[model samples]
Target: MNLTIDEIQDFKGKYPKQIWSLFFSEMWERFCFYGMRGMLVFFMISQLNFHEKEANLQYGATQAFVYAFTFVGGLFADKILGFRKSLFWGGLLMIVGSLILATNPHDFFFLGIAFTVVGTGFFKPNISSMVGQLYKPNDSRADAGFSLFYAGINLGALLGGYLCIAIGKGEIFSSIISESMRWNVAFGLAAFVMVISLINFVFTQRSLGTIGLQPGHPESELQSAPMPKWKEYGVYILSLIFIPIIMKMVSVPEYTDYFMLTVGPLTLIYLFYEMSKVTAAERKKLWAALVFILFSILFWGIYEQSGGSLSIFAAKNLNKDLLGLDPNGVNNSGGAFFIIFLAPLLGLLWIWMSKRKIEPNTIIKFGLGFIFLGLGYYVLFATRLFADLQGITSLNFFTIALLVITLGELCLSPIGLSIMTKLSTKNLQGMMMGMWFLASAYGQYVAGIIGASLVSTNENASNYDALITYTEGYKQLAIYAIIAGVVLILISPLVKKLMQGVK
Candidate 1:
């Protein structure tokens, strides 16, 4: 497996060219995704009239579905359809979904979220695989390439966060605009960004056409024929049965609890089924992947609060105004803006470390991720103390906390899938990747529930509930984050051992 320069040379492209194309493409995709995400919790709790528990449940359910669909999307790309086709289908679906979202802010709102969940399922994973395809195995830069792609994710987040919230919430322009017009403008702008991302990939697919297997692999003895139309159609029909069940769960945010109950046993069944067929080393790899999977979930459960409870804290409590401009609507999406700058530096940081053979092992990196997460939460708790002690609040307090947490995120989130890809065997790659995303499904679900608990008042969000929970929930979350990090760090050696030689 020692990748000599000659082997690596075969896959090399113009690094700058490939990086730029991927960067811009991912930037827009993230913009659309995070733009909606930035507003989701606020929209659900404040605008939707949902009680804290219900809103949180819905938030978790929605995000869970988003990650869960990647399994279906990945199956399509790996088997019947090609990556280009899958990306097109996914992007087109998102555009349609985004449009539906903008059409009206009323009853169909649920429909819009449903469409987005399905659309993201289609889009997220495959495009990422394509970025990895950009580099050859021996090229030492694979991690950096993945990191670059991740930066694109946050770039889009920053744009969406700032622009969408500004337009949707209208603190900057509320005096000059109407709510519906502003909101629609924000949504429409996101749709436009999606279209552009789709366009970039569509035109450029021919260049990397050799990367994804089904496209480049000859139709031969090695290639499996497409599933019969009947079988494909049958799976589609089975999927239809779940649609009603999901719709039925709309009344209960705790539906994810049911999903966990069922998926757990089913997951065990599938693991055994796969393990029965795999070689010993492959089995070890799968088990290793499973170990990382457990830690990964804990990481995201705390990390994803950015979209849930953190957003609310920023909205109702954080002092947004820094230099005297009114800060009311600014907090909604500003974290994304920070990601735009920080993500790339992190990406480059990985590249530099990899070049020097100094990058931390996967488990250690993840351990550090937890540590930073703890520190980030501690920063929040400290900031709360600072606010309470001073009786005067500044946006800087929240900004300081966010900066710390984001740096912690740099240590962990971006590299997770890359770890799974490296550590798992070939056949289980798709399944393990699917599982990785599914972990996020559960994490977001849990985060939503946790976020909802912090939301406080059912009747009015303004101050009545603020008096009840306010900063207390954040204080508690900070403590939870710190403890999780310390525990993960302690177990890092055990987890790293499970990884075998994959690192």
Candidate 2:
């Protein structure tokens, strides 16, 4: 018995009650996730004694798997475990990973990283797919719903960013905890919040009814027959074998490059295979989705620098303090701050525009995002011209650059999530969401490559050299993004036609 899409959306208000449950669950999960993200590279550099290029490579590899695994995780959820079960297992794995970090990050860093990556693969895509399941196809509220969900993600990021930094650098916990143990404490807090997320979801998930119920559930029909038990176990076993392979890739930057070259073509082949099974209209929509996915790689490849080169730039080039806080902590908070203040307004703006039938189509919105991305980087490129003899520039320049990027993110991210759900067929929703993350995986990998190029091994390198390298990279990226955006704008009408009337 398939539940009607409208029945799935049957709630009085603009949002269903279950959305709050999912919201809070995702919120705490993100708190744990982003808290760790905010501090990862710094931890590698400060605690693990990794060089800038080394840390960037490791960061890129780790993030790459964290997303790439989503493709597998989503497939498993759609076929065998169902979304709810996958979510729980993934959340549990993440909790274990976080606890391992808290116990000892240095000795168990690789193990902890492995666990979180696998956990995120299972948890991330399934949770997002469930969010899409809450609404009917093309629900007018879909974009706004995703915006609010995006806000929840940032809310957790805000708290996580601030809390982890406070634990690491602030004096509030200094009396009870020593500075040496601060990073551990921060990780412990992330674990604590994850526990809260798991518990909350376990209790409140009934409100979601049949939304993500898997195995014999109607939504499960979207996928093919589940593999034999032996085959399923074999897949998991084969995946586990890759852990060591990934460890090796993280150790060597060249391996990471090779891995991307391999995965990029494989991803395209997989997309075409899935498209082969769908109707022409759905295939066209998938093509549109691919266009957005392609541009997204460019957008995220640069945007993710907040954790890579830009992070190093802030630490080495910018002033030590920002508003009386650690510059790294303050820098990490930019995304959250922008989302907290701007997400609601954007949400309302989308709904308002939609009501009047004047909302920008998805392709146009993607182009707009690229334009902002270009402007953001170009802003930094301009600041390079103002560098003094020592190559130090105003902190405001960095802040403004980040702020502009946040604008680009707000345009692209939530909208990307919404459009992926809308454009994908019901059966392939989870897989497509994973594909979205896969594109992000490419972006993160390329970002690391780009970051690696900026690293000067002189150890005594001059600030001017670093400034020159960073700004030059930013200039090239700005030009690339703006040109891509303009080209997308030109083809948007064609892309919109390919969308087959999906709004």
Instruction: Output the number of the lDDT-best candidate.
Output: 2
Query: Which regions of candidate 2 fall more than 4 Å away from where they truly are?
Result: 1-5, 169-172, 218-245, 320-322, 383-392, 457-459
Residue-by-residue lDDT tens digits, candidate 1, 1-503? 13322343365542534556766777788888878877677677766787556666677778888787776666666655555566666777778768877877556676666666666766777766656555544345666666666766676776677777667777656777786677667677778999999989765654553544443345322356554666544534544444445544543666667876788568668877978897786677677677777777777777777777666666655554566432333454455556657767777776778778897776677777777777777666565454543233557776776777777777766677676667655445555566778788878877887777776655644442452364666667667766766776677677666666666
Writing each residue's lDDT as its tens digit, candidate 2 over 1-503 gives: 34544666876666666677798999998898788877778888978899889889878877777777888788877766778878888888788889999999889887777777888888899888888888887788888888888887788888887678667664357899987798789988998999999999898665666667766654543445544667556645665665566556656767767878898898789889989999998999999999888889888888888888877876776764346555676677777878878877888898899999999988888888889899999998887876787877656667787788788788889899989999999878888988999889888888887788778767787898888888888889899989988998899999999999888
- What does candidate 1 score on TM? 0.87
| lDDT of model 2 at position 30 | 87
Pick the TM-score winner.
2
Report the C-alpha displacement of residue 401, candidate 2, in angstroms: 2.2
Question: What is the C-alpha local distance difference test score of each model?
Answer: 0.66, 0.81
Which 10 successive residues of model 2 have the least lDDT summed? 218-227
